[model samples]
Target: MTDDVVSALLHPIYVRLQETAVPAGGAGSEYILFFSYTDGRNRARVETFRGPTFADAWHRGLARLRKVVAKHPDMIRWLRVDTVDEMRRSNWAELKRQLTEVKRNYCRQGISLDRNCRHAFLETEINANAMFYGGVEYPHCVVNEKNFRLYAKLRHGLGDVDLKDATLVWMFSSRGFFLDKERPDEVHEIAGPGRSAGCRIVEALDDDLLSKVIKSSSTFLTGQVGDDGRFIYGWHPCFDREIQAYNSLRHASTTYAMIEAWEVTQDAALWAAIERSLAWLLREAICTVTLPDGTEAAFLVDVGNEIKLGANAVAILAFTQHAVVGGCIDHLPLLEKLAQGVLHMQQSKDGSFVHVLNYPDLTVKEAFRTIYYEGEAAFGLMRLYSLTGDERWLSAVEKAFDHFIAKEHWRHNDHWLSYCVNELTRYRPQERYLRFGIENVRDHLDFVLNRITTFPTLLELMMASEAMLARIEAMPDMRHLLGEIDLSKFHRALHFRARYLLNGYFWPELAMFYAKPQRIVGSFFIRHHAFRVRIDDVEHYLSGMVAYRSKLIGNSNRVRKAEATV
Candidate 1:
């Protein structure tokens, strides 16, 4: 048989086999014929393959049959076989066994973190990409080709080497990769799969080409505009397009970065930029536009569709505190009105704030939100009360704290609980507040000193409690506790908290910087016996730094220290 004739015969046979099915319990059979003609030399071959399951052997058999038919078309034509029932039965049995083995292997592999029921289907594309390409570049990291091309032409000739590695190198350098020695392991691990692919496509005389490519890539910081109607930050190529405005993680990050800049630089221009961004948030980003009652409602959204109650509270703190500190009293009424409305949303039936509120419309009943909202809301209310001295605000703060005490919810005494206690202490200077503060501190210390597995939570709690204590001592009545407490332990805790908050990869350095003045004041109070006489001085400094304040001062170091001893 000619090779061409054999090939024609095999094509129909292959097509027919694809439609065939076998019985559930049967072994499968398959056949193939191949004919090769090189120059004048001709060859013919036939093969049969078997397997424990029909699905497995049937596929292999079909492949073999195609090869055979390609080699011996004359033999197949002479046989005059239209369809074979015997072959079909054998093929079905083999296929079944093959499918069974596949099922068994899948069961044996079990579930992995990346392949669980919940995430498996959702991450299908990501998993496939990881398997095929190792790592995917996030949109933020991808360089804008338009800007890079223009920049390359202006700075350097359209040389392939300079332009090729420009974007990649820029990205790496912006991330502090070159300056910092402790590069994350994920960097190399993620780059591993792409290394060979990258090498094949691009070659340079230098081995450091890959590193240079990353360093030259553009960053997100460049394109940010300030309130002064000028490009305050440099332009980033990636941000050229309008990012999704609603419930966007990127927007939240931008807000956080601006807040951090305001804290660090204490620059009015930065603050103005932050105010502009907040205006954008209020005008456009808020999810709930109008309530059923015709009132407008709004809430903050963080990454992962997460509604961040704490963020709203923080925003209120920033704006109101800024107005007060800047002596912009004209803005105070507007700020106070906003703060009151936010506090109303934060209040829980139990008098504490919920951790998060899910009303995208920001118009839902408080019953639907999480308990954590209360913790944040309480803190916000306390700040408002401290600034305005409104009895209603103070009462609200008291009710929130009493809600926790009434419920005896000590389990929540992790970091957030510590924050709640701290906020309450600043608002309420009674002996009970001080005692409760001590208890919360001891709880945190016990958890940390015991070396519990949940040590991070414990450390945060301890630091929060210590910070609370330090703030409380800024008040006259509680100044005595400074002498009774161990200052070294308090300072260490403050340092730990600052470092932990600073180490967070996504946000700005506000948390770290904010903790510094508190730490310094705490340390000073511990060291100086004269602090008793200068308690007013301490209070004045603290009031300037913190959003909350209390008025009162200790008379003498000996008297305050003696009171604490008793």
Candidate 2:
């Protein structure tokens, strides 16, 4: 029965059994069993299983193979486990029959050919003739054949090679992988399953896993709240310790995450941490200014005594959230003063606001020159309007969003705009804002479908959350009140979120081709990033998960209530 079950699950990429004897042909001799598999390209991945005894290594190797085959079924037919040094004790006839069936199934998926996943990468590299460098807008360390392909592999990860003999060396990224003309075959450890760890994928965000990781990642923030209410700004994931780095923006953003977490879990400790952070904000981070223009405002400043528009905006979000949850009106005075700052600072007609102010003196320390702050400011103003019912805050959103649209600033990183638009659609029912939200988020459709990054970044996830909420507002969730928001492209972004959270997981049980072992779980790293954990990375993922969970719960309840009526 066990054999039948295993046979049923076997794919073309299934692992082959081996029965190799001890290497020394003497008692107590140990060995490391290695097998090489290629994806019909020049590249090959050699997975190793080293143990004190041949029997142990073989057993461990087989177990690893089972895991690899489970995650990647396409690599089965190309597996080459029959090493010359090994003794053949496995049943080949049954294995051959299994391969035949698996191949037939794989053919339907168009993966029956031995053509590996790396074939496109290898072919593109071999045919490359021109290499262009030295452009200011080169788009992230690229030689620009539409993103770099491997030229040669670098085994040591840095700095042993002579620069005089180098054919291709990127000093910026410290990447020194150039093939020698004479020694083409003698390249670095670049070809294999391990090399692709840089291209780690994201599985769909699981709610259960999300709950566990949110609790864990937030521990890094809440556990270390200072006796004075300051957050430990940065953490070195490699060493698992705190590093001396501080950003008021990251501090405020993290506080917002804690408040959001508290809303769901109702964790008393988390609430305490929020209060601690609030104390830090009020005592040290914030400044109240009454200018000669007779406009009084509250500004959140950094250590250098400069205030950014976005920080104040997020502070409002944090404070507003805290106020709503705690029923604390003490922060409301500061919140209104902060909203006044946003109101006074926005550029006339252009609708843009200055990035930084010297505070109290009310001088523009830094000109309003960046994009993200506009959306943040607009969203903050909209939130205040939501709580206050003051039409002026809503009026501020309308003015800033108009300037944002005219300047075409809504094209990128527009999650804040989407949230603002979503609120306005609820409050005022404007078609243009709704259209802009959908169109802006729709641009993210390709990122989802292509799995561009292994997982979405916080900004990306926030965009998806807005798109998803807009989706609910448009169709099933709020179809009665308003017509559909025309979410054909925005829908793809949500689909990508589902794909990413589901497909992006890299479990430790899977067979690893890299020599170094890694304890990488609950890490939704982007594509082309190294495998290292960060507090914000998990928090951002949780933000998306929390948003999706709310959507799912709403959907389920709607269905249940509909059925009850039926």
Candidate 3:
């Protein structure tokens, strides 16, 4: 293994590369060096040094590349110590130019499903000639804290670019090799042919576009479910391949979303996937507890012997929702068990639920909590109560309001309370729930409306809008909180937000760059560092859009009825 080059991968050095074209964070310079070459056959190869200025990163990258460099061994070679800034800029310009040509030649596809006509891509390779370029340029990313450390975080897509510290990245423009975490010994390469055109964001709101994005996103998700019902965690868009990661909490959320999609598109494949994922969750992820009265309750859990507060909450909601949608009471037993588990966790004093239950030993821990779990736990109870017509859940819900409202936990960027409030309003018409939900939505909307520079994520926009829209639907007087903006603008914002999803929703098989094209889409990559697309990313997007859409359709029906009466 100590064959210098191969050994270098095991041990890498750290170096500070320049960031000219793509912006950088606090220090401005990024880790890892870009190693690239074009072989005698005129095929280009690119990779990265593993560590910060590590000599091994270069040696290891070059060693695998030897197969190509050896094949031709003689070609018009271009090497550089320069940054990717120039190429990134060039690629952007090249893509725009190509898009313009396609529009002229192909009748301007104009931001619709017709965009699937050609693949749009951006490529960036390392510049070896640092003297000529004056400096090396880094590619862009919404860096995460742990990901920027070249050696620690590596993936197959965007070969050598930084996503280590990225909050979220919508588009990646490169082709190179990335490492698979499960198979650390094997290096996976993502290389593709030059793509044809580009994408231009359409600012105008369109319902048809919203439906298209939802359907496309649903299709990709359905393809990700395994025969065992487990959904694949992440995907590298450039390679169109799955990464090795999984989440139990998301399984329930994805099931909920597929059910929502089934309502809109009535696609059988989606329902099948939902059924599979639900089976997988029940079989592998649930932890059962036998309470004091000898009654058993089930709770959903991720890995480790711990039960997450939110996981159980979402599971209960998903089970209940699925039962309602599928028109079956078969899951009621499991739903009751899951709800009891959540209910048992609540503190008698403040109505907050337990955050984690470490199993085997069954130790309970709730010292501190994140911003959203408390409300999520409460919402789960609300769903169970609504389904069973039990007021025990109601008593817990009001106590939760007493504690959480005093703490003002709803002031932040979570949709837990807003969603819970909206749902609870259905059975109990409390103005407090409606008003609190409205204030949260209005404040966030006001923030977004006032900001002219940046736009919130499609998920966030849909969430706030859904809450307000739901409120106005129940109580017309609340429409004033939306200010001068109407329902159509909210719809437009949702349609536009789909443009930045952490996915390439088009048919990947049509793209020349994808190594393996699958039938589904991957999303929710906004949180993690790898080419990650979590279930929540797809779930939240689906939930918000579907909610608003149903509301809009209902509103339209009411309007039509009123006109007929007049």
Tally clashing residue pairs in candidate 3. 36
Report the error of model 2 at residue 291, Å: 1.5
lDDT per residue for candidate 2 within 1-566, as digits (tens), equals 13232233322112222232334211224353444443322233545454566457656755665666667654432233211132222132332333344211111110000111111122111111111221333322222232122222221122222223222221100011112112333222211122232122334345565565556445545765787888765432222345575767667767877787776777788789889988899998888888568778888887677788988888888888888778887877889898988877887767668898875576888886566777778878877888878888888888887877786764674666666777676776655665666556555656555543445443444454454454556555344433333356555557456545533333221112212113233333322222233445545665665566666556678999999999
10 residues in a row with least lDDT, candidate 3? 126-135
Off by over 4 Å in 2: 1-56, 59-206, 239-241, 454-489, 498-538
* TM-score-best of 1 and 3: 3
TM-score-superior candidate, 2 or 3:
2
TM-score of each: 0.41, 0.63, 0.61
319-438, model 1: which lDDT tens digit per residue? 555555555556455445445555555455657554544545443433435455555556655666667777776677677667767766555564556666676666566766665666
At residue 539, candidate 1 shows an lDDT of 20
Clash totals, every prediction: 62, 18, 36
> Candidate 3 lDDT, tens digit per residue, 1-566?
22443333423111222212232111233223345433212223334443333344455555654554445444213222212221111232333334333211121111100111011122221111010111112122211223323212232232343323222222223223333222335443333222212222234334666676668778778877889998887565433455676778877877877887888888889888988988988899987888777879787877776777788888987888887788878988888788778777777888766788876444686545675777788778887888888887888888887777777765774677776776676776666665666555544644444332222233454565475555666566655544544556555555444444412233121121122223232233331122234566667767666765665677679999999999
Q: Model 1, poorest ten-residue lDDT window?
A: 171-180
- Model 2 scores a C-alpha lDDT of 0.52
**Which ten residues in a row are the worst by lDDT in model 2?**
105-114
lDDT of every predicted structure (CA atoms)? 0.37, 0.52, 0.52
List residue ranges in candidate 3 displaced over 4 A: 1-197, 200-207, 239-241, 446-531, 562-566
Which runs of model 1 end up more than 4 angstroms from their true locations? Answer: 1-263, 285-312, 346-349, 353-369, 414-420, 439-441, 445-464, 471-491, 497-566
Order of the predicted models by lDDT, top scorer first: 3, 2, 1
